[model samples]
Target: MLLAGEQWAARFEEFQREAWRLETLPQYLMPQESEELQEFRDGTRIDPATVHNEYTDRLRRQATQGRLQGRVHIVTRPLAEYLRFEFAWYYAPHSLAGERIRILDVTDRPNPLDGVQDFWMFDHSEVVLMNYEPDGRQINREVFEGDPAKFIEYQRIAISESVSFEEYVTGFDL
Candidate 1:
């Protein structure tokens, strides 16, 4: 089943214990972010520390409720522009709000999770696969009805192989 609008947004709030995500794309073309992205590209940037938005609000709320929210993004070095924007604008602030963001840099090594698609796994049981076009435009979110054991295993591998977002960004200027 495809999830959209409130149905999709509710998953983050509905997860009882943990909400995890695996991000496989370097750029995600979200329509809502177009204007901000363009402004970023045009040399205007927002200080993540002072930025307040719905996402960060959600992260803060989840953290206050003692729920875990985490994600590991698969990426390569000499990062894409979109990845840079994402790191500076989204990841940085989200981390401050208590989201556990990790980076799996596949620059020199072979990708361990090469064929794995992007997905969100709620409470380690419900999986929602994120479908995207080649250029990174989001298509739809599909609920995966199969057993989520593989996704749980994937999460294990990702967390073990990746570095925390703070560690990953220490030397780089994003």
Candidate 2:
């Protein structure tokens, strides 16, 4: 079934134990990040002191409350500029706020988790696949009616093959 708009997106808050995501996109045209993306392109660096928001605040709360929240972003070396900017402004701060961030760099090796698009697997039961246009504009979220096992396996493979965002960054210039 297709879930549209804020109502569906808000499902992130309903996860009880875990809310894990697999990010396979090089860029996402998120409207909220427009100004930040521009500043990033203009060569300004992200400042950690001012990155907190209601979202990150929720992440912190969920984390301390023992709920697992994280994502493994599939990427390649010579990272896309957008990915770099996102890491600097979103991933890093979110990690610090208690959302785990992992990177599955597919630079020199074959991707272990191939053919995977962005998705959120919540509580190991519900799976929501994110649909995006070729240019990375979000279309909508589709809830899978199939078994969650496949998505769960993908999550395992991703987590096993990836590294923490901090560790991943040490190998790059970002």
Candidate 3:
């Protein structure tokens, strides 16, 4: 929703309200420090604050990049856990000492016309193989990478194996 812009992105206050709402749900199970205020009274609050700042920074960078509306998928259990932890402590209520959040320091990428393109290639970090469908849907599969150079070779193979389109314009107006 953040990627689609203001209309789809929930305001901070609204997002907080939703998180609280989620807490009230019967089936919602959260970690110890995130379950309630009691969890933090006995432990340290510094780590959670750092993580919260990092998450906020990530979102801020994405917003600035015009990729704020880009979709994020928690593919692994650890990733999901961290997301929940960040939201529950830093974002939802800052249960640990009311920590302040900040945006991340993200690098800039080239624009669309700059000849560089972002493709749905394989990602080792996420452990998934990305394949595009004719209707624009993406198919992610689990694959192994024994050789580092296999990525370039596989991309070449896929491109050669697929059909492509071309435009035949007969007139031009300068």
TM-scores, all models, native as reference = 0.97, 0.94, 0.21
Task: Tell me the lDDT of candidate 2.
Answer: 0.88
For each candidate, what is the lDDT?
Answer: 0.93, 0.88, 0.29
Question: Which digits, one per residue and each the tens of the lDDT, describe model 3 over residues 1-174?
Answer: 012234223332233211110011111233343444344434434354454454456455444443321111111222233344344454433323332222111124221122211222222111123333433243332333455354444334333332221111112110
Off by over 4 Å in 1: none
Which segments of candidate 3 are over 4 A away from where they belong? 1-52, 69-87, 90-174
lDDT of 2 by residue, 81-165 (tens): 8998999889878988888899999999998888878899999999999999978899989998989999999999999999999
Ranking by lDDT: 1, 2, 3
Writing each residue's lDDT as its tens digit, candidate 1 over 12-70 gives 88999999999999899898889889988998877778878888888889899999899
Best prediction by lDDT: 1
What's the TM for model 2?
Answer: 0.94
Error of 1 at 169 (Å): 0.7
Show the lowest summed lDDT stretch of 10 residues, model 2.
43-52
Ranking by TM-score: 1, 2, 3
